[model samples]
Target: MGTKIGVIGGSGVYEIDGLQDAAWVDIDSPFGAPSDQILTGRLGGVEMAFLPRHGRGHVHSPSTVPYRANIDALKRLGVTDVISVSACGSFREEMAPGDFVIVDQFIDRTFAREKSFFGTGLVAHVSVAHPTCPRLSQACLEAARAEGIKVHDGGTYLAMEGPQFSSMAESKLYRDAWGCDVIGMTNMPEAKLAREAELCYASVAMITDYDSWHPDHGAVDISDIIATLTGNADKARALVARLPALLGPERAPCPHGCDRALEHAILTAPEKRDPAMIEKLSAVAGRVLG
Candidate 1:
């Protein structure tokens, strides 16, 4: 009934100040287990949910992240807006480590994951023409600025399938050829799935390296990234604290129609639709399918 904010990031966001009545709730998802138990609470006079993208102790790899389950779990818990905070490698010279980028677009090169909720018995297609919610992105940009973090208002994120960092050639191609602002292993299917779930979504990419393209910096090192994450995580927490106040405690139909994504997207006729599949979608597409 009210504006429910879902923050998906690292474990640090759970410690954000001003959260009241925090509790870790395990939710059952039609897709499967989410990355971890969702931490639910109230912040800035609005309901809030924080999910650790990689699960506690950093168990899941990039390709292995349960993107569908994560999105569905948030939707099941009544989260209306989703904000994904990811650690990324910067392509631009000025977007250095510790900086944040409010990502507007994505170039997905990931091939080894289920990128959608509709398939087989339940067929559907949703436009990702503009992958993220612009209104939500603006709020994130303001939040990061208010936290005193260096945040770029717009960026294009290149999503790669990886547990491996990019090679110099691949990195250069993304920066110089494809013109990507940041590169990360996640965010492709995650963003796509959010659109399908009809949730307003935004992304905040935390720059942690120059990738392998910068002549001055060699290949990326996990140790350096780990150190940078310690700082970025703090800024992420500060940014999260600013969200609820800006978004408020009431809901509005997304001006961009993100909430109505399924209005004409589902292809399967009601009579021909699979009862099992439709039942599975009861929560995700109840507004349109039922």
Candidate 2:
């Protein structure tokens, strides 16, 4: 068997092609139901699980994506690595529509979501300063290059809390003051939770617009974004299909230390650790306790 990989689809990417024996599996997590049922199958002979970030019919808003459940569900399904494909607006002049960015850093402006797994009874604080796995990022970069796609190796992504697009003032601030490369609504709590679960995480950002900050472009529009996203979706699928071959047949430890983040993070004394919380986190933090 090959290493298990999980792909989180965003925006226009609802499904992946070339997945053999694809079957939808609804997994119940301690957090709750994931955005939707996960589809499991083989891609390039590797075991792959795909979860639509916005739900099957695109029902959930960015703020309502059930991120905790999505991460937990992927963990429960034995997902060792996760590739999040998100649609974003460019903050830089060079990152235009139809291009791909492998984000290495993030600036989270989101507030209303549950961003951690250690709550209630269990309390574990995992390090997230460097979020995405460098190993996986390298693989994604190589895959993108091999596919002849316009790709940027690394950049900072700004994650905002939004059912609404950012205002012109806000967009300008993020682009100028924040020095971010791209902006999007989701990818925060999901990336943080994946770290807490010790799962490798990386994001493939597909630029759809220049946001509201670009002087030459008009204000951010949903209709225009959708059209650009539809075209990028096909490219995203092609990039994913090439990842397994680039990553190889077996798994290797993350060079960036993403998988070992919780090594000493649990602050609660062994005797003080909440039994109820421990039970709830059994699936995710069991190795730490063991």
Clashes of 2: 0
TM-score per candidate, chains pooled:
0.98, 0.97
**Candidate 1: stretches off by over 4 Å:** 11-15
**In model 2, what are the clashing residue pairs, if there are any?**
none
Model 2 misplaced regions, further than 4 Å: none
Query: Taking the tens digit of each residue's C-alpha lDDT, what string does model 2 give over 101-156?
Result: 99999999999998888865567788778889888989899888888989999999
Writing each residue's lDDT as its tens digit, candidate 1 over 42-89 gives: 998999998988888889889999999999999999999999988999
Q: Estimate every model's Cα lDDT from 0 to 1.
A: 0.91, 0.89
Cα TM-score of candidate 1 = 0.98
